[model samples]
Target: MGRDRANIRVDLWADGDWRGLSMGAQHLYQQILTHPTLNYAGVADWRPGRLAALTKDRTAADVQRDACELTEAHFIHADDTTEEVLVRSFARHDGVIRHPRLHVTMANDFAGIASTDIKEFFAFEIQKLNQEQPELALWNHPKVQTILKAKARDMKEVTQRVRQEEAMTFGSATAKPMAKDPNSVSMRTATATATSSKEDIPSSEISDEIPRPDVDELLDLLDSCLLANGTRKPSRNKKNREAARLLLDRDGYKVEQVAWMIRWATADEFWRANILSMSKLREKFDQLKAKAGVATKTPSAGFHGEIDVEAVLGRDVWTPGTPPEGLDVAGEIAWKKEQRNIHNAERLAEAKQKLGIS
Candidate 1:
């Protein structure tokens, strides 16, 4: 049986995650919670089009965008591969562990999940909850272990720790990386590639020489580019490495040229999400180069002298660091001034607090 009701606290409005969301996103979250198809495991059919139809003015694209915002906020998880939406904390919040009989339904619902990514993420959430609330002792339950075992979407079903980790590394071709790896500079790119099934560059294409740190920066640059756009980071393990290698070794693009192209493609509103991997970057390099040339030579004019900076730079979350390639003198000055203003604001707040001002 599906969820008859979900436990939504009245104080939900005061929650940090909830308070930070836009009104549309907040409404979408509520609608999902009360959705008829939401199962015992808190997974609901990912039908944004249908959800959109429920409201008078909401469009499918609006729903999709709000869902993306929610996913990025870590309050929920959406996997297009499985076409499923998961309320990440639902298992704990549902109080299922308090009722032993609910285990059967929870198991059945979890087993029904087609996405291994969701399964892994949900299982981690449950284990984490158990750790924080030892009284739950979730794993100690006999059926709990069997229930949380990730059923492979591609290969044989596995519950072994080794197999689970292996599945995580190479399970879904299009799966987003589960965790950030600290050891690698381009962690997201490496993880995404390691798990991908489509090998654009063959094993034979792999060079005998390890990529230099400078070469690897190409991969890192792609990761940063995506992050700057607030886009989901694709693992860069193979697709990034081989594509970058080919660009340098075979296609004959210099490191600086490739780096500039990386920023160029990623800075475009349309291309940033599309050109995820280094392989994809290589595929679209020429087109990107051509378009970038046009944009640079003639900055798109806005009303009067004002320039639409966003048109030039994709909605990247710019930070205090190396400015993106192709940023004009005016743009650089604006960025620097914004940073200085932020610093001044902080200083003002500190002084006010020290002076016992409200």
Candidate 2:
């Protein structure tokens, strides 16, 4: 008798667009009458029968409308209404700043059709909203706010647990000292050799013979090594070794300085075992020096070195140009003699022309 239950529709709109006009009236009535308030707050302890009853007559329109209204109410009380805190929260959870469509699809399991263009579209939309309507921060949305609050509480508990575990593990490890094996002669020999090598190296040789690696060359080598390793663990150790070699070669840095520059945990240990390996240091230094010499000989390198604004402008300031002081007077004199010979040849040609010689 109630208009023959077959025909009914629920009108719903989201983001200012009509979602759909076709929905069963009975479904709409059931959703309104049986919707649980506790469930909205994420208390999912509802009995199975009650949940089934609530979904019995539900339509896509009903779900969309409810979602929109719930979101709007949450954001209504926020200082920033347009903020997409939900998207931000999702990104943080996933540990990515931005992803292409394929990534997003994989992450969300194709929540909808995902294409590269669609990903770009969403990214652009988010950027525009954040920039133009920052007041709509995602924290304003009820669903996002609820999720964020729960996440915060969970994170705090997790952090506390982790700290407690770490402390206990550290205490146990420290309580038992590593027992020294009475029969370990190899380690003793190695330590003895390292110490002897350090003592045998003369101070004057260490100070006067070593040369520092050029910063650019060191950087390139580090980059190559890091790329090959594909991990940060070896990178630090490699950097320390390279720095020690450079300082040892330059004769300018002490072992402590080398350790400090490379951030070694134990400067004494590094000096004892590593810096004393001066033969390897010399090899690396020679290779780097040869490469630098070749680069310096190239025309491009010459041009780059000669184009200094200060040098060109200050050429007449009477600064010494020699290795220890001013330019070589002998070299200057030889260059002038060559110029004079050229001038004499030109004069002889002019004299021949005046005499009408062929």
TM-score of each: 0.45, 0.15
lDDT agreement with native, every candidate: 0.59, 0.28
Best by lDDT: 1
For all the candidates, what are their Cα RMSDs to the real structure? 19.3, 30.6
Residue-by-residue lDDT tens digits, candidate 2, 208-301: 3344444334434434433332212122222233434445555554443322222221121211111112222332333323322222322221
The residue-by-residue lDDT of candidate 1 on 1-358, one tens digit each, is: 5666777878787788779888877888989999987877778867665787799977554566676556545666665434578887778777777776786667667766766667776777666665687676556666677754544221112212323443454464423332222111121122343433233455575564765676688888888877776555655566567778878877787787787777767765445544666766775566666444423332224212123334433253544565457643335445765784675455534544554544
Pairs in clash, predicted candidate 1: 189-235, 189-236, 189-237, 190-236, 190-237, 192-235, 193-235, 228-317
Model 2: how far residue 308 lies from native, Å:
20
What alpha-carbon RMSD in Å does predicted model 2 have with respect to the real structure? Answer: 30.6
